[model samples]
Target: MTIGVLVLIIISACSRVDGEMNRVERASGGSPIQVVTTIGMISDIVQEVGGTEVVVTGLMGPGVDPHLYKASQGDMKRLEDAEVIFYGGLHLEGKMTEILEKMENKKLTVAVSKDIDRAVLRSGKDAGGSQYDPHIWFDVKHWISATETIYDALVQYDPTNAEQYKKNAETYINKLTELDAEVKDRILEIPENDRILVTAHDAFGYFGEAYGMKVMGLQGISTASEYGSKDVSKLRDFLVENKIKAVFVESSIPTKSMEAVIAGAKEKGHSVNIGGELYSDSMGEPGSDADTYIEMVRHNVNTIVDALK
Candidate 1:
């Protein structure tokens, strides 16, 4: 092996016990399962369902865009040390797909959205043509399904803790179901004519579908997909024609593009206020109001409703 490869293996080995034993040690009630997750949205649900049984290390954190993210060697080490790995698939982590594929045989690598119904998935075109949008967590019902997928994966990998996973998943899913109803109701507070959600990118398609709003983005599904001045000018004209009152900025995307849209709207004798900063590709920072998945959804809904209504 090359010296660099050898060093990484040694560092990973030194960081954890052999065979990810703490997971194997579950029957003995040892350390929790070693889980490594890709995005923060997936990380939250896994933690909720796994509870005290799994210690999840999230690779992408607040404001980190998964579309443009490239895994570092340290991330590779963490993935190697993990007992089980969960990722948001459907090309969410497009750059990391090969690594995840290679690790599946050695570990129980799973896509949390694996069991979600294909019919409901949103498709968008990139330079590579069409693909399913990876922002499923924006749709509460879809995430409810993803929660069960997480439960199954946890049970599959660590059956010893099956009972715990089931209990936690049930509780969390119930709350999400309630959240589904709540948003549907809260969205009604915004007059249907005014419920348009425009953002820096098309990350909120599922959100618009679930909450009864028309969604638009300056960019396409993947932030890696470039948006030109023409795209912005077109969106600006649409906003002015539609009389859209607000546009949202994403935590993970630069605000300059959206700012350009706002400036463009002003020159056309129309005023479009920034609705609020919404947590799109990533959740809020730890301990913040929008940190968790549910709270993040709530924050987005409240921001949208307050700004548009």
Candidate 2:
């Protein structure tokens, strides 16, 4: 080959190598990472810890129930492209877990809820007793531990920002501590006998267990479970016999079922009013008071205390 032709080929190869090096440098630089979370609550936590360092997206939107949610084509694309994916495992996202598990080896996927102690969770709630209650966030104290788990995960993923993540997690936890106190004060206002929280589903079990209240729902711990006629009748009878004053409804699910429960109780000559809608199975919209984990707990406690007290 001519010397000029050989030099031209060498120049072409060098240019290609330089382009590849530039791409690598871009990736290694402190560019904001892409994080995808399964639920809004986890998304909020990620945002708190990662701050502007991350571009986080929540797969489940407002009022979207994750219990029965199936990921769309868009979701899979987002999952594949994300630098990290956070899911609240323990069967919370029932339909999406299997798919996510298969991709565990290929992607940086994490189950944030797995950080909670297994003993603290209540099992045997689902039909076959295999399904555990996945609502650890209902208890603010439990969520404090979840935050620690998240902080640790973030630090591991981005060691350079360890101190920043820790500081952010600490700040959020302090707010949560204040929230726990507020919830206690608010719940104490309810009369002991009137502290019964009758709802559409058994989602509030942990919340009730945390605070001093008797929680009953038409459906089991899972919203996916259908409320049999027996279940409905039994709950209605219990409401009438107990003369429970207020029955609450959830924001994500249809309130028609809960309203029917109220009507059924009233049919038995028991008067029960519909209290304000409770934020259950999902958190509030961004920027709303119920958006943050702390705000959500406080809102629920205040709502319950006001209606039951």
Residue ranges of candidate 2 with Cα displaced over 4 Å: 1-29, 127-130
> lDDT of model 2 at residue 265?
86
Q: What is the C-alpha RMSD of each candidate to the true structure, in Å?
A: 3.2, 9.3
lDDT tens digits by residue: candidate 1, 163-205: 8899999999999999999999999998879989999999899
In model 2, residue pairs whose N, Cα or C atoms come closer than 3 Å (at least 3 residues apart or on different chains), thus clashing, are none
Please provide, for model 2 over 160-255, each residue's C-alpha lDDT reduced to its tens digit, 9 standing for 90 to 100: 777888889999989888877778778889888888888877777777888778888887777788877788789888988888889988878898
- Quote the lDDT for 281 in model 2: 78
lDDT of candidates 1 onward, in order = 0.86, 0.77
Worst 10-residue lDDT window for candidate 1 reads 1-10
Report the CA-based lDDT of candidate 1 relative to the real structure.
0.86
Poorly placed runs, candidate 1 (over 4 Å)? 1-29, 127-130
